[model samples]
Target: MFKSKLFDSIGFIRTTFLIAFFILIFLASITYRHIKELDKISYSIMNTYEVSLELNQLISYIKDAETGHRGYVITNDSIYLEPFIDARENINKSFQSLSSRIDLDTVKQKQLSRIYDLVDKRFYYFKNNFSSKTEFNNDFRNGRIVMDALRKEVNKMLRNENKLLSSKDRLYRYNNSNTPLIIFSTFLISILTLGYGYMRVIKNYKDLMNQNIRLKIFDESSKQAEILGKYGSWVYSIENKTFDYSDNKFRLMGCEPQSFLPNSDNLLDNIHPDDREIIINAFKDIEIAETFPLLRYRIIKKDTLEIRHFKTAAKFFTDRLGNKNMIGTTQDITEDFNKTQLIKLRNKELEQNNKELTEFNHVASHDLQEPLRKIQTFISRIEDKEKENLAETTKAYFEKIQEASNRMRILIDDLLQYSRTNRSEKKFELTDLNTIANNAISELSESIKEKNAQITFKKLHEVNGIPFQLEQLFINIISNSLKYSKPEIPAVIAITSTKTKAYEKPKLKDNSKREYIKITFKDNGLGFEQKYAKKIFLLFNRLYGKNEFPGTGVGLAICKKIVENHKGYIFAKGKPNEGAIFEIYLPV
Candidate 1:
């Protein structure tokens, strides 16, 4: 748009300048005839033969000044201002011409000197800083005043001859009357148009510069990100059949950037011998399918002689010119691939270990318990058959043996339950907590009755979890509370559930975008010291002696394991003699 406007302005200026030139030409010709007639008429009246010619020459210089001023106004060009300067210089020529007449020219010299001084006065205003419209207007008005002064000076030079000259000069004067004002109006319009265009150009240039800077910054930032992330990008032009690689792309191939030009052959050379066909098919696929599907392949590093993993994804792009290009990124995933393989090996080892542990669990549950049962059976037989003959100490030792066997049986049972919790085949089903809690209460009905415990629950939330494991969780926690209940006070276990977000509970540790069912079991039991809250959940971790609390020290550990299986968390909060709260958070 700026270029078009500039061309239009140049064209307008050319037309105006040409029109001014012709107008000046037409005025000059008329003025020339008028001067010729005045010269003849004056010679007959006075002996001033060179007077008319000198005066006509002066008129031509004035015409040059007008044309210069008009051009300067129309074009707003410094080049046009040169004519004003030229007029100033050429006025001296007019003075010199009128001076060397060698006729009785004392009066002419005085009058000519006054004209020269008036010309100087005319240019004085212009010579000052005159770029603005107001300055131009003032200079133009001064020019008209000087023109009048100069004409008056000319008339005074030959008073009697002027009467004949004035009659002929009137036609020339009338012809050029409105030229200066018309030219000045064109000058103002031209200045306004040019100023507006210049401002728009500056504004556009600034906007373009800002966009370019942002693009360059983005390019640099993307390059840095690729380097830090161990990735590289490449572009393939279908029209040119050429390959262009980012700097990091060359580095990934174990060479300095641009050390080797990227082409299909060179790219294939970097690929592992076993995986080279995969890359060959990738390049072929761009044209065959017009798309490159995801490809995970291996490349052999030239420097390290080690295989590195690479995965590429690309899409076909047609630019504004309809040139097809395939742009893709390949990342160095050696670390991630190796870690994944290591995890698979570790998982296999764990599976084998779990199988052995399951076998051990069977042995502990039955094989080991068989011998213990027999020992208990032998003791029972001795007490029934020879009770009178046995000593009191001997009877006491037998009773102690019975208690040890019972404790051992309890230990084996608890260990077996813990092993099942560790099993990985946990199938999740949406289990209602209200039903689970009621089931736990019914199962422990005898214990609840004996302990005179109150197990109250309401508004228990539901969650997707293993039904059997969740049941075991509720049973173990309730049993634990009953076992620790204060002797003087009836046990009060209140189970309640509320909906909550993960971040709301910092103890959950994982601030994911998930909703959790916070099932809290608050019990008025003989709670332990707050310091042992975390320690109480470990395997065989007992806060009190076996006589104080008859437990295998493994029930809470099993509860933690079961909660973890359901992708949940449990925390134990306690106060000495006050109460204990077991918080179980399962994802909803």
Candidate 2:
């Protein structure tokens, strides 16, 4: 956010400076024009004064000629004639100068023409009267009249010149007074604009400084996370064709950070020889590919010279400047890879051991049960035919042998069943619990009757399962209840079913939203302590000794295995001397 705002502020400052620059240019242009106007007005004022001065000079020369002529007319002096003769040439020169000055002004030029005519008539009197005595008095009177007329005309021209001079002076004063304020206002506006731009720049600079500090802290934290996680990140910029390796990236190669530049060749040098071609081919399409697929290979650490497994994956994205880049992380998976291989090897060995054990059990079961059957057959014949001759003590020993043989036969049969249950290749079919429960009850009908036990159930749920296994599960659970029943009270077993969600039963500890058919078996038998609920389902985990309980401890274990085979869960709950409950959940 700060970076974006900073860019906006920079653009604003540039625009402000641009506006200020144009204002400066405008101010210069206006000031220069104002100066030119003022200069023109000043020149006009000077010309007005010069024209007035020339008119006054012309009058002075005519007056000098009149004064000298008067002196010569009374005393007849030749020096007076010299003054009169010089005044004529001086008056003509003054008239020429005044006409040139007022030529562009029509009104002023007409007035100057009248003054020139008056002067010419006065000069004609001076020459005409000097040659005739009778007309000399009249000529002198006429010359004096012309001289007075010339003075009046010259004074009129002077008044007009003075009026023009006053007009030009007022205009010059007005322009001179306004120019300074106009220029000053423009300069001040430019200064204020620059000041605002400077303040904005300062504020953005401080914001950028704070943001930079935060970014540096974030970068450091990311580096630490990479190092601790045994992973390293790298970036490939397609536009620049450049690579950037994080500090941990170099460390992953067992080299110090930035020990060498990041590039394809340097990275490939650390890869195992057999995997080098794979890594090389993967990168060859990096420029055109949108992403890098997950790749696992082996690399030789530079410092340790040890081969370690590594896996890398990356996705391609375009930066704000439209530069294509791919960022990927490479992890040191040597420990995980070795553990995975070990598990695979152990799994193979365990599978082989189980197979051999199953074959042996198959062979040994037939051999062992045959001998036990033969022993039972021989013992029964002895007991039947030689009972009368046998001593009571001998009969008691024979009974003990018979009991031992029966227990051994049951144990051997249970072991074989367990081995078959452990095989994963058993075929599954849609099986109904109602039918399985009825079949199991019928099979154990003799024992149920002997214990006066009631095996009751409603319509149970159907499931995809191994049919024989389900029947076996029911038979074992019912027999267990019958065996553990209190001698005072008849055993009562209830099988019930309901549909429920997995999360509804906390003991199931599953969070799936799928529905399950829960089948519960409640028995009013000598249930063990609640603490031993989970232990009862483990193989060979019997609560009572063999002398007290006739069970081989494999019944509930087989039940648990069958439930698991159908992707179901089995849980047991018990209360001492009260009853036990087994709940099984199977997917619908």
Candidate 3:
């Protein structure tokens, strides 16, 4: 539709140009005719004015000569005859000038000739006066009659010239009036044509710019796709025996783009010696095979001299002309391949480290515990035996030693337990959480009773987990609530469990499509600030000094490790003086 509209608009513009061309031609012709008519009228008007002026001068000169002749005849004065001589000199010149001017009109020319004859006859009468006064008067009267005839002839010529001037003036006025309209019409047409052409040019420029922008966007999208996928495309024509590789393909091979045409030989030359055989065999079998699975190999980069991995997949297709061809995609998987290798190496290292740690734990457990236990026993004995005999300062020092010894023992024990979590065999079993909670409470009975703690729980769902670890997890959490209970307020810890999908719990950070048991432990205890929630789970990380709250700080860390062993997560939410909650998620 757009294309059709564009063509239609172009057609309209062309038609408009053709029409404007004819308009200009017509305007030009009309203007030429108007100018020609104006020129002719101007010429006629000039001739009429010239003829009128010359006829008036001739009449004046004739009247002057007649007056002077009359004065000379009356007084016979030579001064009076001066006017006659001057008039004679100028009259002939005026007559010649008038005749030349009015020559274009034959009627005017004849009138002018008659006027000249009458003037000449009047001058002859002035020059040759009759001897008698009567003859002179009679001759003067005849000259007056001739003068009247000359006046009528001059008036006739003037009238004829006036008519010509009026007619030419009308023509000139008509042409002058039309000239403005013609010029305005031409200007309007020219403006419209120029405006239309300018609009077309602007429209074409905008369209070209828009098309350029779209092409650039498409180019950017293509380049982004190549970069994101770490892959490039290629085609091999079997008939022509030519290979075509994409720009990114050359870049992936650590070579500058467009350096050279890609061929099977150059490609194989870059392949590692060990993988070259595999690639060669794969291509050799392509003619017989319809398709193949992904082929992976390694190459030594020319620029960096680094070994890199590449993978490709190809399929055979027949062109419309019945020529066989292969189209394929090659990906630079070096980063991913290197990451996998690094992970394998890390896992091996971790395994070896874990083994060595387990051995150290076993040795330390035996070697350190016996000595620590003996020291605690010896301190207790000394505290009892020398309690009354020692001075107050000595007794205070003994208490310090005893406290240090006790703390040392607890540290060694907790350290041993924390290590065992990673070293122990993961023996998973289906066990009731309620049973686990009851066993944990039973083990912490002394602390619960001392704190007057109210531990509440209902029958919880059974889940797949290590039974001993789950029990230990509950025991540590319950013990924490009992130990940290605010003074003068009875401790209250509520245990609850609900079945839910893993994704439903936002804090789990597990997106697996599996069900889980969300077991929560809420307590009304002297909870630490929420900021220390994660820190508390780290081994030996304590929020308070030993004088304020005596602990190894390894209980929560052990709980975290145990939960991890069961493929679960445990996190805490706490607010000072408000309360604390520990949420545990175990896959069901």
Candidate 4:
């Protein structure tokens, strides 16, 4: 609505200019009128000033004349008479000027006439007294009365003129103050109005230019995207048997952009010999199909002979004249295809290696166990037969040999369990961890009894996991707590479980959006430092010497493998002489 009223009237720019012009003209006219008014008031005040001066001069002359007359009558001095004479002439001249100045005021003119009459009477009385002593005595009282009346009249006239002067001066001052204010107000208003209008006009124009520039930028960006994305658009006109490929399409074929018009023969020539028949069949089928089918094929670059993968998708379109056309995009998928192939190759290689490793672990454990068992059996027989007769050093050496064989046996057993944890059948079942923890405790009954360990657990959450592995996970952690208990302190192991979100476990880097069952194995055992939390899970990693803790350091490694095979995670937290907590997360 504002645009219609302003812009449609005379165009926005022109209308704004016209409005500014008129505002300036209006301001100038107002300023001129105020100045004229100020000048008029000033002139009137100057005239009033002259009247005030005249009134003061008239009073001064009257005083001088009275003094001269009094001095001449008392001392009879002619020198004093000169002053009196000059004052008399000056007094009449001042009165005449005062009368002319006050001609515009009838009341003031009347007051002046009365004052003149009283002065004339006082002059007559003084003239008669100046001549005779007896006449002076008789007329002295009347002369004093006339003199008093003249003074009263002059005072009245002076007061009236002063009031007139004051009124005119006030008017002049008012005009003087209002003139500048009026001019400044008008000028400021005009300038502000013009500034606001021009600013809006400029802003609108810039906005329009920016919109146009943005549209051009978007168009350029779309073309640049097609080129940088290694894709190009094409339109095939079936009626004319002509193919129109974009500039990028030509470049994708290893020809100069827009070098030549493309046709079916040219496209087929670039196709790999193995995929040529497939494209030919697809093209023939699309001629009758209602919807276009996606086609993938390989093409050989004309200049470099380099093979490139291309995928094309088109839609069937009919023009107004019923001409059949196909519009499609062709993307160069060489890089993506190569990456996919490499990933597949890596996955196959990893699968074969894992199978070989699993087989080797089982075979090695099986083959090494026979010798280990035979050595242990022979050592046991030797101890039973000669331990009593052997010397003390020989007896100690025999005991050490038995201890080494036993350790070797345990190491092979633990190694087999660690490998089997990864190769075991991974079948998920809804298993209650309360049952699993109880089962682990049952398996460690002998150790728990020896240490007087108090193993505590509550109603735990059930989760989807491999049940046997979950059982083994609890056994390994609880067994560690039993083995590492502080001296003279009964081992206290607490097993607790709760339903929790994956994000709550900061150490478990997995799918954080899922829910999991967090089972905590907290124990008051001889805990290690916090820094060795991750190190403890590594295979063959031990925090204490073999003499201090008896086990191949592969127990926790087996526990980690079991949890991972069940798609879960385990981490440990420890503080010296305080306790250790082994936290496990299994998806629910």
Candidate 5:
């Protein structure tokens, strides 16, 4: 019965294989014919491209020649005659090039020859008329006739070429229409072949009942272990001398199951030399005592020679027939190991960098403050002691120095604030942004009063933020609005906020929670060009001169730093002469 069943299966497989072979033959024939058609189409396209290029060159040459001829006729300048002469000399070459590319059809060839003859005749008449000092009107009339005839012949050739191109394009469309049918047929054949293969597997399982029963328990347990550990198993039979590998087991070894089989000797050979002995001893212990069901080691990939860490556990099991089988699983731990090492190295480097930056900022800021203090002190002394005795120009110079010193002081303070923002720990809480905006407005009351600015506030939302930093951000932005107000209009400052639900807070290193707050600060000020919107955030960037707007350009820079420290972003939008709007997005 078994022999008869085997013969039946063989016959079935043979029939299916024959069907597959015939399908492959059909596919190959279609592909071959398609390739030939494609080659012809490609040649036709290249010829068309060449012909078009030649025609364009000819047109350009004719236009240049006509321009030069007209200039020489009007101005009687010999210099203008050079281009005409050069074009006349090159005209024959262009005609020859076009003639060479024309199709070998008699009509097309004859048309090209006629065009060439007419162009030659026109050139000869032009040259003779110019040399003999013939009347311009007669020469022009004859030249027009010859050019017209030549143009007619060229147009005829172009029509024939375009017809041929259209035919080729239709052929391409016809071939494309057949492609979908061919692809569908190929896919159908593939699906039928795969179904046949699946059926064969099922039949084999049914016929090999005893062997299947023995493997059933082992396969299920191996699969369970693999899923639990993100691993897979393999086995090498000593007596039968056959190798078996699971799908994931082959993947862990960086090999295909059909290409490489797992074996004791092959596995050992692929292991890192330093880890080989360790794995061998572990395997031996498991085999001898049958006590442990797990072993772990590192192996090197054959292609990359990179060490891949692995952990495996296995046991020897005997069937009812006393056949011994070894089963084991391997887990790849290379990624986990590498990630741990990377974390350690990065943490060390970051700690060292943080220490260096902290010291640098402290020393740099302290050193810069001393010189600024001396300048301020000297300027104050000059104004207090020598005001009346000094000349007007000298006094003006002293005032300028004092203004500069004051600006420098503000810059230094802003710089310190910006640097401190980077190091300050955020203390997030529900804070009223309306109160913050009011406080900033109150702080700038003197400037607002001087400028006669009309400031308005809408109901602002309470958002999650560091209160002090939020307050500082509000002050800088509001102060900027007052400073750059339009000369003609009262500065109109509007403050408003809206809750944003869709906003995502940027993740911190510790993976903390965040929220979002949307605030808009609009001002009717001497607005800048839109291009300067982003640039205004950079330190020391000023759109207007100090005489026009007086402030250290660090205000926006500080606002940007503070917003970023609070896990937020600020963007400006404005057009020349229009009002500026600053949008701030804060994460709660």
Candidate 6:
């Protein structure tokens, strides 16, 4: 009874196997047809690539020949002419190669024949023109026209070849859809033949489920990270060779999700106009090195025109298909950039405040001297009349008080003038320095005569500055020169102006446009050492003591402030006992 049952099961199994085998054979026939179609398409594609390669070579040869021709013409060099001949010969060879590869399609064959005829005609014409000395003009122009026509024909053929290549690519892609179906059917038939196939199928199903779950988790984590960090991730598609950005990335770019396309142009358009070329060059560098580096740039928002700073770290990823994908994170660093700018602004503000305070101290001290001087003079007048009536020690004390008051008054006045030097809120007007200088000299005419000082001036320029301030500047400088003159020598002051824009500090103004001017003041007096060049521009900074030269040491400091307020700079150069030169650069 058991043998009979086993025979019966074996017979049934054989019948089932026969039916499955027949079905497989039927499917195999259909798969074979699909595969044959794919092979034909692939062959067509290969032929197209061959034609394209040859045509491209031909185009390159022609360009080389043209370049060589121009070079030889420019230099009249026989060496360059040899290259031109070589390139021309290679052009013919490349055309022959293309011809052998391309099939006899009516449109392509016609275009190819026309190209051959034109090439031959141009070659003959160019060869004849090579030795012709008859003022090569109109004939050479005709040759160019013929060559251009030939190039156009070749281009047309290339386009046709590209179309064919595209067609083959599409066919192959469509045929590929049947491959997976055929493979799955074969797998199914094999599984049906194996009795333990169900166990394998269940295992594969479980593995697929786990893989999908992991993929989902990864995606969720990436999205969460992007949102929290205000960063966006991007991937490049190998098939399309295009960039794809995540939704978060679109948001970060200040663009709609649908509008965001990962491309060089789109990204560059968002960059600050000034920084666009810089960012583009950086991207090219990465592409050439096949490396990814962190890039920072400013992006101008499209709608709002608000600028935002962004930082990105990018690297190229090659997929299994050997296609490049650029993956990176984009982050907004606008706040950080703004904070840096704000800190710089605050530092500048603090510096300005400190300068203002110094000026105020000088002015306040100087102004107080007037009242103090009045007090001292009145006390002296009263004490002078009663001096003999008092004790000898008392009279000496009164004389001492008078001397102290006089010194104090001088100190206060000097401080006051120094503080007010460049702090006045007066508008600048066009003032001629020559006129101003003469007027300043006239005001000090008595002093100049008394000291027997000689002041000379070069033709001064018309500059935009306050007249009063300029007058004061000249007065202080001239007074210093007279006070520090070499003993027994007449004070000689030489003022000259040079046309210069060198080192002119740009003015901070609402308008973008402005002009500039330059002037210099040179004096022959008791000059100090070069080491004190910058130190001289400080309050109470005197190179000599009161006994050597009487000054509150505020003149140069006031000069520096005035020059700076005029959006100019002042620098002094001198040697001990030599003359001093002060150069001022101003933006008008």
Q: Largest lDDT belongs to which candidate?
A: 2
Runs of candidate 3 with Cα error greater than 4 angstroms are: 1-232, 237-267, 300-308, 321-323, 334-366, 373-403, 446-454, 485-492, 500-516, 522-538, 541-549, 564-581, 585-588
Clashes of each: 1, 0, 0, 0, 3, 3
- Which portions of model 1 miss their true places by more than 4 Å? 1-225, 303-306, 342-367, 380-389, 458-461, 488-492, 499-515, 520-525, 569-583
lDDT of each: 0.80, 0.85, 0.84, 0.83, 0.76, 0.74
TM-score for all models, in order of appearance: 0.60, 0.77, 0.50, 0.60, 0.47, 0.42
**Model 4, span 1-588: residue lDDT tens:** 744554453466677777778878887887778778768766766766787677667767767877887788888877878877898899799888877777888888888888788777777766614466777776777877887787777777667666876786687677567667767877787788778777877777776688679888986786798899999899999777679888788888888988887887776988999999877887885667756668888999988999999999988799878999999999999999999999999999999898999999988987899999999999888888878999999989888999998999998999888888878888888998889888998999999999999999888888888889888888899998999999789999998888888776666665467888788989999898999999999999999999988988899998888878767788899999999999888778
lDDT tens digits, residue span 476-524, model 3: 9998888788988999999999999877877777676789889999999
10 residues in a row with least lDDT, candidate 3: 284-293
Ranking by TM-score: 2, 4, 1, 3, 5, 6
Question: What is the overall TM-score of model 2 with all chains considered together?
Answer: 0.77
In order, what is each prediction's RMSD in angstroms?
21.7, 5.0, 17.9, 23.1, 46.1, 40.0
lDDT of 6: 0.74
The residue pairs that clash in candidate 2, if any, are none
Whichever of 1 and 2 has more lDDT, that candidate is: 2
How far in Å is the alpha carbon of 348 misplaced in model 5?
A: 4.6
Off by over 4 Å in 4: 1-219, 383-392, 505-513
lDDT of 1 by residue, 404-438 (tens): 98899898788878887775477889999999998
Name the weakest run of 10 consecutive residues (lDDT summed) in model 4. Answer: 2-11
Residue 259 alpha-carbon offset, candidate 3, angstroms: 8.1
